[model samples]
Structures are given as structure tokens and as C-alpha cells.
Target chain A: DVKVTQSSRYLVKRTGEKVFLECVQDMDHENMFWYRQDPGLGLRLIYFSYDVKMKEKGDIPEGYSVSREKKERFSLILESASTNQTSMYLCASVGSTDEQYFGPGTRLTVT
Target chain B: EDKVVQSPLSLVVHEGDTVTLNCSYEVTNFRSLLWYKQEKKAPTFLFMLTSSGIEKKSGRLSSILDKKELFSILNITATQTGDSAIYLCAHCNYNQGGKLIFGQGTELSVKP
Candidate 1:
């Protein structure tokens, strides 16, 4: 079985505070992705990493950044948390089977 | 930009009813189309369609792709309360740098 775990299931942050979201995959997948899901807008990609130390921006990556220093770890960083940045964040990893396993998700609230 | 659209945005049905969720896409250099089921938190993979006309089935759930029509449909038969969830459709392009453009998704409600 494939397992993906996120750092937090819920987070509360004050405005202008920096936030960090962590994800770890146990399947040693080569591709990892971060997405934020909002009602009516569905899920939008934030960032993705195909390999260690390499990252690519997704559709809505303006307020977010990512780091992948190891094969199984990916981190999403918010430079400064804003009210608009509050949303449910999801992390996923894909392997040779072309299937992506997703983490439970982190619901962040900016106050 | 690659675009994916799914409709009707939401649906309600009773137990034992069959439902078909639709997805259409306009993608450049299409690699594959994927379907996922989101119950509570993260979405889980359901089907990955590459070839047209061939249907992928897993017990009560099935899906088929149409390359010519640029569309796909996921059918769930004999749905139960447990089958109620949001169905998402996404398209993978060849040059998007591993990006998957997703549809807004169809929220399904199955009543017992």
C-alpha cells in the first residue's frame, strides 16, 4: 500500500506570518505535487517536483514555494500567510504505475 | 492553456441509482486523462484513460474515453451512500512540466 502523510490536518496562522507545510511519501515515488482545493474552483496546482532539488510552478503558485531536498520529502512554504491564502492543501506523489496517491490534506486558516 | 470541464456541477440521487459523470477537455499535446474520487480530504485515483473506446471497470465503477469527442464519462451503477463523493477529471499534457489541469468536479449525493 502507498502512503502519503501531511504535516498537519489543520493549521491556524496570523496574517503576515510565514507558514510551512510538509509532506512525506513512503512509496519512493519520483513525482510529488502540491494543490489547494477551494469550493466551486476545485483543486488547483500550486507546485510540483519531478526529482530532488528540482521544482516547477503550477497554475496558482504566486504566494507559494516548494522545496524537495530528499526523494520522500516535499515542503510547501508560504512567504506570508494572507486571508486569501487560506484553503485546504493537498499533497500527492506518483510512481511508475502512473497512479497518484494523495495525503489526507491540511486545512489552513489565516486570521 | 489546457482546459478541463465537468458537468453537471452537482447531482443528487437515491440509492441503487446509476449515474454518469461527464468530462470534456481541450488540451494541447494530450498525454492522458484521469479520474479521481474525493470523499473527505484528498482525491484518490480512479481511472487513467489513454486509449479511446476501451472501458475501464472496477466492480460498480466504470469509465470510458473518447479521443475524437475530447470527452470521457464515468458511470457508477447501484450507487450506495458510500458512493457519494466528488468526482474529478483531469488532463495531463506532454509539455506542462508534470502539471495536471483539473475540472471543477461533480459533487454527487447519494441518499439511502
Candidate 2:
């Protein structure tokens, strides 16, 4: 089984603070993604990395960035946390056309 | 732009009842359609449908995709309280790095 692990299950940050969400996958999948899920909005992609040091912006990338320094780890960075940035963040990994395996998710709350 | 839509937004059924969830999509360079079951945390893989008219099944859950009609249906028989979850449908496009375009999802609640 593929296992995806997120660094934190829940987090709370003050406004204007910097936040980091980490993810690691044991499957060594070539593609990793970060998504924010909201009620009525579904899961919207924030950023994705196809290979080490290669990143692409997804539909909603503003105020968010990602890092893929290694094949097994991906990190999402919040430049300046705000109330609007509070959301359920999910990390996923996939190899080829197979289904994506997702981490347990991190529920971030910005105050 | 690629898009996936699912309906009805939510449903409630009693145990032992059967329920059907619907998903429709409009995408370029379509590759495959996938189903996922999400509880409170992560979404778990359910089925992946690449061909039309063929049904994929696991236990009481089954799904079929119709490429020509650009839609799919997921059916659950003998529903149990454990079957209550958000069912998500995603369309994959290889040209888009196999990026999955997901529907809003159908929330199913089974009462015992």
C-alpha cells in the first residue's frame, strides 16, 4: 500500500505569520500535489511538482508556493497566513495513470 | 477548461437500501475517470474506469462510465451506516500531467 504522511494533522497560526505544511510519500511517486478543500468549492489545486525542483501553479496559487527538494518530500508554504487561508489542506501522490494516494490532511486555522 | 459535476449534492438512505450517485464531465484529452470515498480525513480510492459500458465492482459498490455520454454512475447496494461518506468523481487528462479535475462530490448518509 502507498502511504502518504503529512507533517501536521491540525495547526493554528496568527495573521501575517509564515506557515509550512510538509508531506512525505513512501511510494516514490513522480507527481505530488497540494490542494485546499472548502465547502461548496470542492478540492482546488494549489501547486504540484512533477520532479525535484520542478513546480507548476495550479488553479489557485496566490499566496501559496511549494517545494520539492527531494523525490519523497513535498512542502507547501504560506507566505503570509490570513483568515482566508484557513482550510483543509491535502497532499497527494501518483505514479503514471494510477489513482492518487492522499495523506490524512492538515486542517489549518488562521486567526 | 476541464470541469466535472456531481449530483444530487447530498442524499440520505436507510440501511439495506440502494443508492445511485451521478457524475458528469467535459474535458479535453480525457484519459480515465476515478471514484473516491472520503470520510473526515483523506479520500480513499474506490474505482478507476477507463472504458465505457464495463462495470467495476467491490463488495456492494459498483461504478460504470459512459465515454460517449461523458457521465458516470456509482451504485451501492445494501447500504450500511459505514457507507456514509462523500463520493468524489475525478476526470484525468494525461496532457494536463494527469491532473485530476474533481466534481463537487455527493455526500451520502445511511441511517441504521
Candidate 3:
């Protein structure tokens, strides 16, 4: 079985505070992704890393950054979290099969 | 830009009703189409369709892809309350650095 774990299930941060959401996958997949899901907008990609020390911007990468120092771990960084960034953040890893297995998610609330 | 769009943004149905969710895409170098179910948190993988005219089934949930038409449909038959969730459609393109482009998703609400 594939397992993806997030650093926190729920997080609360003040405005302008930096937030770090970590994700670790036991599958050793090459691709890792960060997405934020809103009520009507659905899940929108924030960033993705295909390799260690390499990252790519997704559709909505304006307020988020990602780091992949190792193959099994990926971290999402919110430079300065704001109220608009309050949403459920998800991390996913995809192996050779193209199935992106996702973590439970981190619900971030910026007050 | 590579895009995926799902129709019927929200649907409400009673138990045992059959529902068909539509997904259409216009992407360059399409690799595969994937269906996922999201209840509250993460989107769970449902099906991945690469070839056209082939149906992927899991119990009452099935999906079909049409490469030429650039669309796909996910059908849920004999639905139960457990089937109520947000259904997502995403497309993978070779040129997108293996990233999957996702649609807005269809919100399904099943009532007894």
C-alpha cells in the first residue's frame, strides 16, 4: 500500500506569518505535487517537484513555494500567509503508473 | 493553455439514481485522463483512461474516454449515500512536466 503523510492535519497562522507544510511519501515516487482546494474552484495546483532541488510552478503558484531536498519528502512553503490562502492544502506523489496518490491534507487558516 | 472542464458543476439526486459526469479537455500532447473522488480532503484516484473507447469500471463506478473527441464521462450506477462527493477530472500532458491539469470538479450530493 502507498502512504502519503502530511505534517499537520490542521494549522492556524496569523496574517503575514510564514507557514511550512511538509509531506512524506513512502512510495518513493519521482513526482510530488502541492494543491490548494477551495469550495467552488476545486483543487488547483500550487507547485510540483519532479526531482530533488528542482521545482516547477503550477497554475496558482503566486503565494506558495515548494522544496524537495530528498526523493521521499516534499515541503510546501507559504511565503507570507494571508486570509486568501486559507484553504485545504494537499500533497500528492505519482509513481510510474501515473496515479497520483494524495495525502490526507492540511487545512490552513490564516487569521 | 492546457485545460480540463467538467460540466454540471453541482448535482443533487436521490439514492439509486444514476449520474453521469462529463469532462472535456483541449490539451497538447495528451497522455491520460484521470477520474478522482474528493469528499472532504484529498482526491482519491478512481480511474485512469489512456486509450479511447475503453471503459474502466469499479463496482457501480465506470468511466469511458474518447481521445478523438477530447472528452470523458464518469458514470455511477445504483448510487448510494456513500457516492456523494466531489468528482474531479484531470488530464496529463507529456509537455507539462508530467503534471496533471485538473478541472473545477462536479459536486455530487446524494440524498436518501
What lDDT does the true structure give each of the candidates?
A: 0.93, 0.94, 0.92
Which tens-of-lDDT digit does each residue in B1-112 have in candidate 3? 9889999999999999999999999999989999999987788999999999999999999999999889999999998999999999999887765588889999999999
Better of 2 and 3 by DockQ: 2
Fnat of each candidate: 0.63, 0.53, 0.63
lDDT of 2 by residue, B1-112 (tens): 9999999999999999999999999998889999999999899999999999999999999999999999999999999999999999998886867578889989999999
Q: What DockQ results for candidate 2? A: 0.74
Best by lDDT: 2
- C-alpha lDDT of candidate 3 relative to the true structure: 0.92
The TM-scores of all predictions, comma-separated, are 0.97, 0.98, 0.97
Candidate 1's residue-wise lDDT over B3-40, tens digit each? 99999999999999999999999989988899999998
Which runs in model 1 stand beyond 4 Å of their true positions?
A: B96-98
Off by over 4 Å in 2: none
Query: Model 3: runs farther than 4 Å from truth?
Result: none
Clashing pairs in 3: none
Number of the top DockQ candidate: 2
**Positional deviation of residue A14's Cα in model 2 after best superposition, in angstroms:** 0.6
